[model samples]
Target: MGTVLLAAGVLLWSAAHLFKRLQPAKRAELGDTGRLYATVAIFASILLMVLGYRWADPVWLWPRAGWMIHLNNLLVFVAFYMFAVSGLKTSLARRIRHPQLTGFKAWAVAHLLVAGSVQGVILFGGLLAWAVVSVIVINRANRDWTRPPEAAIWREGVALVAAVFLMLVVGIIHGWVGPWPFGGGA
Candidate 1:
């Protein structure tokens, strides 16, 4: 059930992005509605997965030690920083227009290292695969890899702050919420 929900989330998420590239006209037609549906789909999928997780029994396949979770968290922290930078008009985005995608890959990789359950594979593993494929597809479709614009220093500063905020949030969740997706208690 968790795996199904995870796959559904991935498929919905991928379809949402792929549609924009493959059928821009259709996407424009729906406009905000399209976005709304995509958002709903994503939320629904995640909600279903959460329920499945709570209901199903855990089966650790290749669990990593809790100590190594710190490494995974660090990697995810870097990815979170990249994700923040990618949203801004920083040189990072210009150089890597797909910083979010790359960050997603990094995040997925980090999670994969710590998560070895069937649920983990379906969620993080699927996301990792999607991120890699999406990056390649986006690059091929754009055919333009121009350098990104340099945002104001203040904007960069804001991004840095946001990254730090995200890291704190992740840390809190990992420590207090009991990392079910990835083994907790380090």
Candidate 2:
């Protein structure tokens, strides 16, 4: 049942994201309303996915390695930094048009490395594929890219600080709810 829900949630989320790219004319016709509906579906699907993943029985494919956890932690930190910089008016943002998607890719990959269960593979692998496809679709859609205005270097510093703070908060929550990120005893 949980696997079914997980698959359904992944499909819903992927479909919602791809709808605009697949049917641009239809998406434009709906305008703001379409975006709102898509947003809601994405959030709802995410909720369902999380719940399904938690409830599903674990079927580990391989032994958990300590090094994998360390690597995942590092990649997650980088992902958070990319996410933080994506919204900020920084030079990095101007250079990386899809920092958010890149961050999502990193996040999904990081989790995938550590989680060997069927649910983990479905959830993280689905998201990674989505991010990859999204980047490709977006790049093809926007042929002419206009670079953003230059931002102060200090803005990047601020983004980095914020990223660190976000990482701390998320790590704390992860430790509380699931695995201890630091390889400590669960």
Candidate 3:
């Protein structure tokens, strides 16, 4: 049952993002409703995935080998860098509105290196697929890649703060937070 829910959540989450590129005029007319539905689907899917994982039985296959863990850390570091630069006003984000999504994919892929389970695969795999597809869609839809230089010191500052916060969270989760539904100490 838990596995089923996790898979369902991933499917729903992917579907919402996949359809986000449908007719611009229609999407505009749908307005907040469309946004709301997308938000709801994303949130609900995530919630369901979490709950399913919490309730599911674990079946770990690969041990968190030293190299895998190191890779995870490396990818996470890159994720933070991508996330930070994407929000900077240095004409970086103009090329990508989905740095956050890229970060998510990195995070998921990194985790998969250490975690091997049906639930883990579904959650991370779904998110990874969504990130890739969304990025492609956005890249295709974008017309003007050029823009005047814009700088927001505050935005950069906030991104730094967020990066620090996320680093701390990762440390806690990976080092202190128990493996819980998984095993072998998180």
lDDT of each: 0.74, 0.89, 0.73
How does model 1 score by TM-score? 0.82
Q: Against the true structure, whose lDDT is highest?
A: 2
lDDT of 1: 0.74
| Pairs clashing within candidate 2 | none
Winner of 2 and 3 under lDDT: 2
Per-residue C-alpha lDDT of model 3 across residues 6-32, encoded as one tens digit per residue: 888888888777766846777678899
**How high is the lDDT of residue 45 in model 1?**
64
Give the candidate number with the greatest TM-score.
2
lDDT of 3 at 9: 84
**97-131: candidate 2 lDDT, tens digit per residue:** 88888888889999999998888999999889888
- Alpha-carbon error at 91 in model 2, in Å? 1.3
TM-score of 3: 0.77
Instruction: Name the candidate, 1 or 3, with the larger lDDT value.
Output: 1
Candidate 1 lDDT over residue span 1-186, tens digit each: 655665676677677667777777888899899888877777876676566555555678896877667778777877987888887766566666777877888888888887777777777887788788777777787896777666677866877788889888877786675554334334
Q: What stretches of model 2 exceed 4 Å from their correct place?
A: none
Clashes of each: 1, 0, 0
